[model samples]
Target: MSSATTYESTSSGHMCDMDRTPIRHAEAIAARNERDEVYAKEAKARELLRITKRKAEKTKLALRIAEDKVYKYRQALFLSWTVLGVYFVFSTVFGGHGHMQLHLP
Candidate 1:
């Protein structure tokens, strides 16, 4: 997909050769195109890897957040149970009546 413009010397019956070597022939263009295709594939693979890594990171973050929530819930449950036990102990020691009270609003 490239255009090459060459000027011919009419007086000398010669042509200016900008790319004269065998390595710089039409085959070189095909080789360059093949190389570009390979490079494109490699770039695509790298992009996919980055996306996969990001997904894994997000999953890990979500798991950590969930663990923290569960830990907090357990701590709260333990604290409430301890408070209930303390209340029961104080009532028994003070000889409180064994009557239950419920308040509704």
Candidate 2:
């Protein structure tokens, strides 16, 4: 329901001359109300789309960070295993049972 500030309201609703065409007061109000409803729905939909996009972006960023951390963890694990293996090999080879000597390249 809107105001009848046009000073042409009857017993039912407001009346005004629109584009040189006479229209029913109820029809005019209904058209205006329908347009308002459409605009509101569109605005709400756009807001929802924007929020969803933002959430997706944040989720993607978090996933990328987690993947990077896992990759670094795997690399470090491999390096530690390699170093330990080398230490054990040198210790066993030179531990008096084998009596091996190493020459640097």
Per-model TM-score, in order, reads 0.59, 0.67
lDDT, each prediction: 0.82, 0.81
Tens digits of per-residue lDDT, candidate 2, 40-81, equal 999999999999999999999999999999999999999999
Q: Candidate 1: global Cα-lDDT?
A: 0.82
Candidate 1 lDDT by residue in tens digits, 1-105: 222355545356664455455447778998999999999999999999999999999999999999999999999999999999999898888787455566669
- lDDT value, residue 40 of candidate 2: 100
Error of 1 at 55 (Å): 1.3
Strongest candidate by lDDT:
1
Q: Supply candidate 1's per-residue lDDT for 52.
A: 100
Q: Indicate the worst ten consecutive residues by lDDT in candidate 2.
A: 14-23
- Model 2 per-residue lDDT at 3: 38
